[model samples]
Target: MKASRVASARSWLRTSNVPSDEYLEGIYYVQGRDFVDAGIVSSEIKKNLKEKGIPESIIRKVAVVTFEAEVNIISYAEQGTIQYYVEPGSITIEAKDIGIGIEDIELAQQEGYSTADDSIREMGFGAGMGLANIRKYSDEFEITSVPKEGTYLRSTIYVNGK
Candidate 1:
């Protein structure tokens, strides 16, 4: 397979009619050196989603997916950004990170597979369930990755869920 390409999120923003950068409520730069700071970033996501009028139920689901995705950046990647956007009837969460791309997405998606060190596990993550949970909670999901470049995850949870 060819290396995944980078797709600017401009199209989605334009399609949603929300200014590409205007819709972004908050941005977080997560690094491996500080897990607490990264964890705190979760609240920013929640606040923005709430302000967007996303249903509490759906927001909870989005939170699960977002937190899991953000933790992946913290544990594996050097640093990354978590961007938030609001659309007509949904909240979008995008995680972009520069890290060693997953060589086998199929294997990485397995519920019990993990490459995290003991330090991560002791912190209450790295149970190898982040991706699985992300898959479980996100209503719409897409992941693109490049070996030496990075990984990008886009997910949406509708405000009025089906």
Candidate 2:
């Protein structure tokens, strides 16, 4: 099941969208147990982008990237924020959390390396693919964490695939 999810993410990244140069952006406040709320916000953004003539492919990338980031926060952080930016050159998705930060970012990035306990695992989440999927679907990715401070993850998907 995890393999299939990963494969599906890979497929999302493979699609291409027509390049845009206009700047667009949105911000979302993410709370724990609010995946549905996040999804609604994401869908609105996707719809807006599509109406603006942003290709479906690019919108899909934004959805996938944002969903992964949101899920990570929902599963791990007590609270967090997800920011979306649609620039002329690229789309940027950032997740910032105020909770126990990642102790080893390197290990966290590795596929199948998860810290989710039995409770989270029992829910069929925390396969440790969140960060990996975010990185895989993005053209540029960066992550930072401070023990007890929190974690910040950002991913950029270029409009022109640059």
Candidate 3:
């Protein structure tokens, strides 16, 4: 976290009624709907990364990956949360949801392979590019899912542009 953001966050913590732990943990909730709040979620992450003085290239990649991951939860899960932490040389993003999980991780990562339905497809998304795009932008990626339990995705991008 940057000095400005840290100071702002501390001010928010003092004024806001939300828990301090959640703020410290950097968790953001997501709600799936006809059109989920994917942009809002992504922008928040971008704002934090920018405040930290992360490179623009890295910020852009993180924004894209974050949006895709959020949309996946919105399209497939009942609810989910995106958790992120900034370390000295890297930032980690973890998305967890409770909904129908992917049956095949490998297949899902294939470009142009999507399980999105017609409605979601109509929204200009679900082109089978979400996972592939995410992977393209992430330096490291990991996904885990079960039949009915849910899915979890973790991605890490190096801050030093490594």
Q: Between which residue pairs do clashes occur in model 1? A: none
Writing each residue's lDDT as its tens digit, candidate 1 over 1-162 gives 111111222111111233343354556666643454445556666766666565789878877877888788878886677776676677788889988877888888899899988767877999889888888888888888887677899888877886
Name the top lDDT candidate. Answer: 3
Better of 1 and 3 by lDDT: 3
Off by over 4 Å in 1: 1-24, 51-53
- Model 2 vs. true fold: TM: 0.78
Worst 10 residues of 2 by lDDT: 8-17
**Candidate 3: where are CA atoms >4 Å away?**
1-25, 34-36
lDDT of each residue in 28-147, candidate 2, tens digit only:
666654433435445656776777777777788888888777777767787777777777778888889998889999999999999877656665567988788888889999999998
On a 0 to 100 scale, what is the lDDT of residue 50 in model 1?
Answer: 69
> Which scores better on lDDT, 1 or 2?
2
Error of model 2, residue 62, in angstroms: 1.3
Candidate numbers sorted by TM-score from highest down: 3, 1, 2
List lDDT for all candidates, in order.
Answer: 0.71, 0.74, 0.76
The whole-model C-alpha lDDT of candidate 2 against the native structure comes to 0.74
